[model samples]
Target: MEGHKLGRAPNFTGACIVMFGVNLGWILLLLFAVYGLVAAIFLGLVVNHWVSWLEHRKQLADQRYGDVSGDT
Candidate 1:
């Protein structure tokens, strides 16, 4: 019997490169998403604390001035 040459192996380098790029893109996107979420949470907390502080100041002012009707 004569030896025969088999078909060349499939070239997967291009596919691998594309998959790598896609994976990197997804990883970066997820990182930014998490950062945005954390930033939003911190911003909300800061805003809430500021508003509460202002309200507390107003209450103290009212108590000091005896303005219970909230007109002042």
Candidate 2:
């Protein structure tokens, strides 16, 4: 098929570079989101453990000192 040239053919090198950049950007963004999600979950677990430990210590203290106060 004899086709007339449209203005100018698109540059293959430029297209490839643009696509590579876009894919790299998306990959980086996805990695960052996953890292943040994992970090948040880890921090939440740590906080929960810390709170439980504090509660346990408080209970132990009260159990030991409760006999001395006659304020039942």
TM-score: which candidate is best? 1
Tens-digit per-residue lDDT, 1-72, candidate 2: 368666886759878979976975675567568787666566556766987999798778879877464545
RMSD of 1: 26.9
Residue 53 alpha-carbon offset, candidate 2, angstroms: 0.1
Candidate 1, pairs of clashing residues? none
Best by lDDT: 1
- On the 0 to 100 scale, the lDDT of residue 70 in model 2 is 54
* Candidate 2 residue spans exceeding 4 A from truth: 1-35, 67-72
lDDT of 1 by residue, 1-72 (tens): 268868799979899979976975675567568787676566556766987999999889888988877555
Clash count, candidate 2: 0
Q: How does model 2 score by TM-score?
A: 0.44
| Residue 8, model 2: Cα distance from true site in angstroms | 85
